[model samples]
Each structure stands twice: as C-alpha cells, then as structure tokens.
Target chain A: MATEAQGESGGGLEFHPMDQFIVSPLFGDGGVAWYTITNATLWMALAVAAVFALLVMGTAQRQIIPTRMQSVAELAYGFIYKMVEDICGKDGVKYFPYIMTLFMFIVFSNFLGLLPMAFTPTSHIAVTAVMAFAVFIAVTVLGFVKNGAGFLGLFWVSSAPLPLRPVLALIEVISYFVRPVSHSIRLAGNMMAGHAVIKVFAGFAAIAAIAPLSVVAITAMYGLEVLVSFIQAYVFTILTCVYLKDALHPHH
Target chain B: MATDTHSSAGDGVAAASAPGMPQLDFSTFGNQIFWLVLALIAIYLVLSRMALPRIGAVLAERQGTITNDIAKAEDLNKRAKEAEAAYEQALADARTEAQRIIAETKVGIKQDLDAAIAKADAEIAAKSADAEKAIAEIRAGAMDAVRDVATDTVGEIVTAMGGKADPADLAAAVQARMKG
Candidate 1:
C-alpha cells in the first residue's frame, strides 16, 4: 500500500483496474469463506433487488396502459420471451423464466458495475463459469432425458460424407464441450477487457498534458461498455436458448 | 485526482495481496459463486413466482383489450356502412315512389283528357245530326210550297182565258212545268 502511494507520489501512472474486481469482505479484512458476505454478495443482492424492483415491484400495479417502468418490464419480457420461442420453439417457452433470470442478472450486474467504484460480478470467471456450467449441465441432462440415446446426434454430422463424418463428429464433440468455457469466458472477458481499458485510460489521466484525451477515451469506452453490457446479456440469453434448442431437438 | 481515486478504491482490498487478475484468484471463487447462485436463485424465484405471471397477464390483457377495441371499432364501422346503405336505399325508394306517382298521375290525366275529348266529339256529332234533320225537313217543305203555288197559278190562268180545261190536265201541266 505504501509502495502504491509512493508510486503515485513519484508521478508514475497507477492502474488498479483489478482492485475494483476483487471479491473482498465488505466488513473486516480476512480470508473469503464460501459463506462470507463480501462486496460480491452486496452487489449480487443488489442485482437481485434490482430484478425484483423492476420485474416484481415495478409492475405491481399491472396497468393495461403501462407506466414507464411497467413498459420497460413488458419490453424485457417480450424480448426474452420471443427469443426463447423463436430459437427453442414453443416447447422452449417453458424455460423462459430461467433464461430471463440469467439475462436480467447479467445485464444488471454489467450496468451496475459501470457505476464508479462498483464491483462487477459478471467480470469474474468464477461467477460466469458457474452460470455457464449450470446451463451446459442442465441442457445436457435435458437432452439425454428427452432424447435418450439420440442426444449423441448433436455430435454426429449426418450431412457429411461417411468417411469425413468421424472427423466432423470429433470436432463437433470438442466444440460441444467448449460451449460453457467460451460462453463464460466471452462474457467475463468482454467485461474485464472493457473495464480494464477504461481503468487504464483513467490511469493515463494522471498525466496533466494528456488528461483531456484520457477523459475523452474513458467517455468513449464507457459508451461502448454500456452497449456491451446489454449486448452481452442478450448474447448469453440467446446462446442459452440455442443450447436449449439443441437439447430439445438434439438431432438437428 | 487519478491517484486519489485509485488509492482510495484500492484501499478496500489492499489489505490482501493484490493478484494481477482478481478473477483468477481461486480463494474468492467460493464467495462470488455462492453469492451469484444465491442471487440467481432469488431472481429466478421472484420472476417465476410473481413477476413473470403478472407481466404475462398484463401483456395478454392488453392484447385482449386492443383486439377487443379494434373489433368494436370495426363493428361500428360496419354499422355505419350499413346505415349509409340503408339511407341510400330509402332515398332510392322515395325517388322511385315519387316517379311512380308522377307516372300514375300522368296516365290518369291523359285518360281523363281523352275521355273528355271523346264526349265532346260525340255531343257535337249528335247536335250536327239533329240540325241536319231539321234543315232537311225545312228544305222539303219549301219544295212542296213552290209546287202548290204553281198549281194554283195554273188554275187561275185557265179561268181568266175562259177555256174549258180539265182539272187533271191543268194539274198535269203545272206538274210538268214545275218538274222542268
């Protein structure tokens, strides 16, 4: 800590982008237990509260001619509902609640993380990986439960030549396994990268001569981060729908 | 400003040795993942139980309302169109009735005028026939009176000449002169 302060005093640029991402205890400083109520818990609870505020309390009145908040809620419902129905078909609509949960949480986390001095839960590999693995495991189980032995058809490319089918199937199986990794990493990486870039640019603002340009870069990156936040949530939800589609109709 | 912000923000977790990437710090994975699962579960429960159904119902109700309103509007439009059609029908009926009445009146007037002309023609023909009969009778009477005068003059001439003439012969001579 003294060295960081010393580094700052020496007129060197300070970059603590990961400090914002650290999952430390909200109260006393110690090892983070599994049950510890850390900043991650606060922010996660905030995400839950946000979801509840918007989805539950915001639409409590349930007016036919909606208020602005209710309209936003309805828009979100329609958007995710249509995605599930479109990608996974009508049968997939049953899972709309689950997909919607993931979307709302991730989206809220990303946006809330954009707030100054806020921790991004989605930026952590552990959090996103848990979600991605949950989806992967659930979809796999659902596929096998629904299709039995036919669930393996997801790997077997019937359209390819009989000789090439084996090679294609190998690649397909590997990619199938990689879905969770890519899914989790894609979100976490985008969040981490954008935020880290913003922090780096913010660090550059310590230079008096380039402060204006750094501020401009941060502003631009912030705008792009806002877009990425929503888009990542959308992509995650859509991919979940796609995976669910594969589970429901594994033959295709 | 940047140093102040970085130091203050960093002071929260500066107690722990700062990892290059906090995301890879497996020590905190349990905490983040556990909270994330809790949040996800909480959100899922909230959405599935209360929020989703309410929003779904509201959307459906709104759709129903919009559909009902549109249907009502369409019904009103249909009714309006029917009313206009009925109005046009009534107007046509009135025009047809008026034309029929005018045609009927014209027929009646033409019939009455024809009957009056026929009656006048018949009355004038009867009057002329009666007048011709009277004139014919007067003309016959005038011829008879002339013949009679001729006969009397023949008789007087015979008497003044002192000739013993037969009455029949005189009469025959008068008749012949008159015939000529």
Candidate 2:
C-alpha cells in the first residue's frame, strides 16, 4: 500500500523506515512543545485508560465467578503480586501497586503499538529511560532510607578476600548504576528493532518478484514481535522487583 | 514514473534535512518526558486508589467466602454425625426393650404351665381314691351272703337222711362236719 502511494505520486519505491518513530504534534504540524498533545501522549493516555478499563471498570462487580475481563484483571494482579512477593519477599509486597502499574503500562503500550497505524511509545528510549531512571532513583533512595549507611553493604563482597573486596565493590557499584541504562535499552531496542525490521520487509514488498516472500517474512516477524512484546514487559517488571529486593535487603 | 522519482527525491532531501534521528532529537524530549511523567503519575494514582483496592477486596472477599463455606460444611457434618449416633442409641434401646419383653413373656408362660399341671394331678388322685373304696365295699357284701347260703343247705341234708335225733345234736354234727 505504501509503495502504491509512492508509485501514484510518480516516485520510485523509496521507504524511510525510521520516519515512523517521529514524534509529531497531534493537532498541528508545528514542533512538539512541552504541552503539545503528541502521538506519544495520546498512546500513553490510551494505555492508562486500557489499564483502568480492565482493572477498575472490568472488576467493578468483583464477581466470585469472574467475567472474562475480571479474570484478565485478576490474573494480571496476581501475576505481579506473586512476582513481587517471590522476588522481594513479603515486606516488599507493599510496593506491588507501583510495579503492577509499570507492567500494565509497558505491556499495553507494546500490544497497542502492534496495530497497523499505531504508535508504540515504549519503542522510544525517552519513555523507557524515564521509567528505568525512576526505578533506579527510587530503589537507591529507599535502600539508603531503609538501611541507613548500610545500604553500601550491597556493594561490599564479604565472601571475597579482604584485598579484593574494594575491587569487587567498585565493580558492583558500576553495574548497579548501569542497571537503568541496560534496562531501558533492552525494552526500547527490542520494540524498535522488531518494528523497523517489519517496515523493511514491507518496503521490500514493492518488488513484484519478492512480494510473496516479503509478506511471509512480515507475518513471521509479527508473531515473534507479539511474543517479544509481552516478554519484554515481563522482563522489565521482574527486574524492577529484583531492584526493589536489593533495596529492601541490602545485606545480600 | 517521472513524478514518482521527483517526489522520491524531495522526500529524501526532507529526510536528510530533518533532524538526525527522531529519538536523538532532544528538542521534544522535554515535552515527551513531561507528558510521560504526567501519564505515569496519573496511572499510578488510578491503580493504587481505585483499581488495586477493588481487586484486592474481591480476592479477600472470595477467600473469606470459601473459608466460611468450608466451616459451615464442617458444622453440618458434625451435626450429621451426632444425629447418626443418636439414631444408633435409640435403636439399641429399642432392642433392649424388646429383649426384656420376650424374657418376661417366657417366664410367665412357664409359671402358668407348672400351676396347671399341679392342679390336674391333685384332681386325678382324689378321684382314684373314691373308686378304690367303692370296690372294697362290694367285695365284702358278696362274701357274707355266700356264707349264709352254705349253712342253710347243710342243715336240710342232715334232717332228711337221719333217724330221730335232738335238734341241738344235729346242729352240732352239722357244725362239726362243716368245720372238718
């Protein structure tokens, strides 16, 4: 379809795959302002609304025998709840709500982005970075607040020899700070790569000879992206739980 | 084809002239981050206040209902067991009462049988004694009558065959012959 549009305009098949990631003003063609309701804003709001519909309105009745939406909502709730408890222990379950919100937002954004013309906010490093930074900052603050100066004990390797302890501590500190970068990049890279690859395949479909092969490749990629989308969300959430565990128990 | 190439060239120039990469374009980062934080805060509030509590309540309520139902079932089972025990006790009592009645009946029947047998024996003994007394009286009377007849016959024979003799002497001879 894209190639046909280009052909109609007397253009040869030229596809700019990265153009899809552009964040433009939803209302006007002007540059995005801080208050401008961009496509990212709309999709992010939609994700929140989706979570509300499933978790709040869907479970409004709280039926003993749950409806399909309620079942989904409860399943999500239990899934995140169990993850938090298992990873962070009972004490850390107090923060289950925040973790649940993060999971729902990311997963919903990913699944919604799979729509033909939809925007995936999670594919942008800016969005994932903010979430990762928030987790990093919050856990670090909580670690100190809860454990006092002993929070540094997280970096100290008691098992190592006394001479090697300082080196191990430096390594641990660097890796600890690197968590947010890796965490953000993992999600954004997976989502961005899958979408770009699909677009490239779609562009290849312009050729009559390879059109069928392009379609098959797109189909396969789409399936993999579906799995990737959910898995990435789960990975991000579980990692958050792990960080929270570290904050709660710095001794380990 | 000419128009397609023209538009394609223009798109390529526009793409090149545009910012390096939209992701790297920091001009909009401020806007995106602001909205993202706003959106995330809104989501967190809604989940914490409205959605999560509702879900938690539902789960807690379901758990409570299950436990209550189980407790009620246990109570009913206990009552059923009690009722069964009572039924068994009543059955045992009835069996005992029936056995007592059977035993009493057997003893009463035996006592009545023994009393009847004793009364019949006494009546039979009294009747047999009266029969024996009557037979003895009849035998004594017949013996006395036969003796008197024999004495008269002997006196007549002596008077017909003898010469003149004293009545006393004849009588004596008869007596002596009879004796001999």
Candidate 3:
C-alpha cells in the first residue's frame, strides 16, 4: 500500500487540505502582490460573467412565455425582490438592485466553486468581509443620516426595568457591532468548512481500504455543501435586508 | 540537485511557516474589495437598466392583455344574454298574435253562420206560405168545377127526363156534403 511505502520512507502522508485555499499568483511563481491577478480574481470574474449571462443574455428575448433560462433568471429576480420587500417593507425595495447584485454574485461564486479545481472567492474573509463591512457602514450611515440622534434609540431598551436599561443597552450595542463579524464569518466559515471537509475526504480516498467510504463521505458532504452554498447566500442577503430594515425604521 | 532542494525547502516553508488560515491574510483585501465593488456595480447596472425593465414590461403587458380579454368576453356575454331575452319576448308576442287571430276568425265564422241560418229560415217561411196560398186557390177552383159539372150532369139528366135542376141549389148541396 502507498501508506506502507510512505511509512518505510521517512516522509509521512502529507496531504495539505488547506493548500487548496492558498491565494497564489495566477500568471507565474511570483508572489501575489496587491494588483497581481490571482485565482480569486479569475473566479470572481467568472462569477460576474455567469451572473451577466443569466440575467442579461438569458432574458434578451423577453418572451411572454419564458424559456427555461429566462425562467431561472426571473425566478432569482423575484426571489430577492420579494425578500427585500417582505423583510424591509416598501422602503427597502428601492435598494433591491444592490441586494440582488450581492445575492447573484455570492450564489454564482458558491456554485462555481463546486466545479472541479475551481476557487471559491466567497470562502475568503477578505471577500465576504468587504461585503459585510459595506453593509455595516451603509446601514450605520443610513441609520444616522435618516434618523439622526434617534438612531441611538435602536440600542435603548424601553421595555426593560429602569435599572437594567443601561446594561441591556450595552448588550444591544455590542450585538449591533457584532453584526458584521457574524455576517461575514457565517458565509465564509460555512463555505470554507464544507470545502475543507471535502478535501479531507478526498485525501482519505488514496487509502485502498477506506477509498469507498471516503467516496461516499465526499458525496454526502458535497450534497450538504450544495445546500449550504445556497442557504449561506440566502442568509447573507436576508441579514442585509434585516440591517437595512433597522436602518430604515430604527425605532426598536 | 540544488534546485530540487530549494523547491522542497520552499514547500516546507510554505507548509510550516505560513499562517494556519489564509482567510486571516489581510494583504489581498484591497484587491478583492476593489474587484467586488466593480463587479457588483456592473451587475446592478445590468439589472436596473436592462433586465428588470424588460421583465417588468412583459409582465405588465401580459396582465393588460388578460384583463382586456376578460372585459371583452364579459361584454359579449352580456350582449348574448340580451339577445336571448329579446328572442324569448318576440316568440311570446308571436304566439299571442296567433291566438288573437284564431279567436277573431272563429268569431267571424260564427257571425256568418248565424246570418246564413236566419236567411235560410226566412226563405223557408216565405216558400211555405206561397205553397199554402197556391194549394188553397187550387182547392177552391177544383170545388167550383165539381159543382158546375154536377149541375150540368143533373140538368142534362133532367132534360133527358124532361126535368130542369137549380144551379144555386146544386152548388150549395155539394159544398154542404164536402163540409160534412
């Protein structure tokens, strides 16, 4: 067995599963500078292209009875449109284009990452944090700009006892600040964990004794990851809607 | 041999010295954020300007067409209902007219029959009266002739036997015998 041969040789079975997520330069062996195109850039560009093809080219005909691709594009549009409307009310619907763009990019990136040897830009904190921070800054600024000092009322707990109000307010402020952290981590963590688990299973497939089990585990994890991919995208978008709602109506 | 060692050492450095998680690396955040914003802006433009308007137009057109078709169908249905009622009313009117004509014809026929019956009755009465008059006249004439013949015969017999009879007496005797 290869395991036995590796044992006889000094080197052990060295399968670096996290190596798949390395942000190396795409062109040559050069280190990734700030501007050097990398795997993340390529996949991000592909995600953008996929979104364009689905939303723009797919619906170019604008048939009364939509074709299959058009149906998919319309379904995605209506899905996010309804989500924003339902969560943030009519006022939040104006920002639907931004939310829709965010959802399409994340979902397409997640889906493309499932392809063989594909990089998932969404799995990186660098990518997800940018989106999360953007949402955080936008909602915070909107809250202050729209509500002025009344935005601080979002932290005030009127229902609590007068003695506990300050403590509860503190907790609310902490949680409010934690929103971006949790938002960014939730998507990136779920994606990174699922992909890492699959890579680990694939590593086990080299052993003859447990190769079949490893394949089954990979299949199951892949199925779960597919669900996670869509769900994480949905969760990220809905949370953005929730924050937008808070910004729009920060009374409670 | 030196190149091989260097490559192996580089792999070793990457595996051992690198951060445990690549996500914690903040160096590439600028690039990812820059590109993400660009891509997202492009998507937003495509959606807002191109895709959403087209889809909205199609949906609105379909709704308009459906509502218009429904209204047209409803109008046609109302007209059909009015036509049906008008047909029923005309049918009833024709039936009543037919009944009135039949009744009038029957009354006219009855009046004509009554007049004809009266005329026949009058003509029968007139003809019977005429016949009775003629019979009466013939009877009287016959009676007179018989009396005359009796007188002549008697006178002739008398003459033959040299005896003359009275004509007034013969006539009165014959009339009295006929009466008895």
Predict model 2's lDDT versus the native. Answer: 0.85
Candidate 3 residue-wise lDDT, A1-252, digit = tens: 233234336443334456566666677766557677878888988988898899889988888788999889888988998999999999898989889989998999999999867889999998898899999999999999999999999999888889998999999999999999999999999999999889878877878898999999999999999999999999999999999999999877
DockQ for every prediction shown: 0.46, 0.30, 0.27
> Can you tell me the CAPRI class of model 3?
acceptable
Instruction: Summarize candidate 3's per-residue lDDT along B69-170 as a digit string, tens digits.
Output: 999999999999999999999999999999999999999999999999999999999999999999999998998898778767766776789766676776
Q: Which model scores highest in lDDT?
A: 1
Q: Tell me the interface RMSD of model 3, in angstroms.
A: 4.7
User: Where does candidate 3 stray beyond 4 Å?
Assistant: A1-14, A159-164, B1-17, B84-180
Supply the TM-score for candidate 1: 0.82
The CAPRI quality class of candidate 2 comes to: acceptable
TM-score of 2: 0.76
Give the per-residue lDDT of model 1 (tens digit) for A1-252.
454465557767676655567676777756689999998999889889999999888999989889999999999999999999999999999999999999999999999999988888999999999999999999999999999999999999888889999999999999999999999999999999999889888878989999999999999999999999999999999999999999999875
The local distance difference test score of model 1 is 0.88
Looking at model 1, residue B126 earns an lDDT score of: 99
